[model samples]
Target: MIGFMPMLSKELRELGSSLKILYIPIVFTLLTIMQPVTLKMLPTLLKDASNLPEGTIIQIPDPSVIDVMGSLLPKFGSLGSIIIILIIMGEIAGERASGVMAMVFAKPISYVGYFAAKLIAGSLLVIVSLFAGMIISSYYTEIMFDKVDWLDAMLGTLLYVPYILMTVAITLCCSAFMKSQVGAGGVAFVLYLVLTMVPQYLGSFFRKVSPSHLVDTASNVIMGVADTHIVAPLVGTLVLCSVFIAAGMLLLRRQEV
Candidate 1:
């Protein structure tokens, strides 16, 4: 792990210089806040946009604060995943292409350190952005609906972090071995779909154990459901993240860069 801290600082500096530090949080915040705002305004929006006959009424009920908060994870899961892939898909592949990897490796850094730095930096960016968005969205949800429990919101967000971490690990793993950034992004996206979606068809057990299940667990947490079933999905997600990080490091070490 030689030069790990310096390497991490470099990665974070690059992210800031690239303005990902500015826009990612904004995008995620918008993605999260939109859920509650749209839900709150749905009835009015529908009524205004409709071409219905005169005196026709759209009577959609407003969602509760719990429901609004519970809906955030699914929104983040789909769009936020794509945003993460786009941001990290080029982290390794682009460096390798531009000969930056060779320059960086010329230092006393171990491949493990380099890989770990990338993983941590990317994960930090996404995790911070997610929490920023969640906090702001929670505030808006409370304002538009009812009061939200801070403890529940924070715990639910914490539970959802593993999914985001797994996303970074998978993207970096693809970037480490693939020569093309676009190819890495595509493959990562496909793998993301497979990992999140395929388990459902396999069995209830698989579905419950998959990383995607963590989103459901987080949603349940926000909704105040008292289930002890969170352990499997949480452990499964962390283990999956470790497997990908190890694989990425192994693949990176084999490369000429």
Candidate 2:
């Protein structure tokens, strides 16, 4: 196995210069634009009542920067989820299919170094994208709501980072496992769907350990709307990441050269 430092450095250079890495910044940029537009439009959205009493008076909420984050963050995060999973899937499965995996294997680099670089790099890409979206969303939210505070928005976004990391680990495992981009993408999506809807269909008690639960809980925690009630998710995410990476490495070692 190649030394850790050189392997990591080499992997970083490969990832940094790749076209696939463009997915992160592009996805993030789109979300950034979407946030403000969605927040700015929410008030008009809520005001449109499908059915209301003739004399009823409904108060329309003026969109605020926080509202943008509140409404858009979760949704944007979901979108980012797709991009992250696809990117990871491509990094792992696509490379194997396209022969990049074989080339990497020929080098002196450890499998651990190769996969770890992608995992970390992918996470950083997600972070940058999320951060950009937050900034754009906040700027627009403030314009609409007139209650935007810079500090609150910044702090809230800071609280969002761990959740992103957790997501990276979650998807990365799937990517490493499937060795096919489509398969990894499908796995992540299915997990996301179950997590996203279970709380509404079932009771809230299941939120503790659910991956979907973690995403929602973390968002709420950041916004100060709810207490930090989903500690299980945080712990589960770490476990999930470790498990995925371990499985990926084990598989890598066993793959026929």
Candidate with maximal TM-score? 1
**Once superposed on the true structure, which residue ranges of model 2 sit more than 4 Å away at CA?**
1-7, 10-23, 32-35, 42-59, 194-205
What is the RMSD of candidate 1?
A: 1.0
- Predicted structure 2, TM vs. truth: 0.76
Per-residue alpha-carbon lDDT of model 1 for 3-95, expressed as tens digits?
A: 899999999998899898889999999999999999989988888898889899788877878889899988878889999999999999999
Candidate 2 per-residue lDDT, tens place, 87-150, comes to 6666777777788777877878777776677777777777776777677666766666665656
The per-residue C-alpha lDDT of model 2 at residue 140 equals 60
Question: RMSD in angstroms, all models?
Answer: 1.0, 4.4
- Distance from true location, Cα of 232 in model 1, Å: 0.4
Clashing residue pairs for model 2: 32-133, 63-145, 65-141
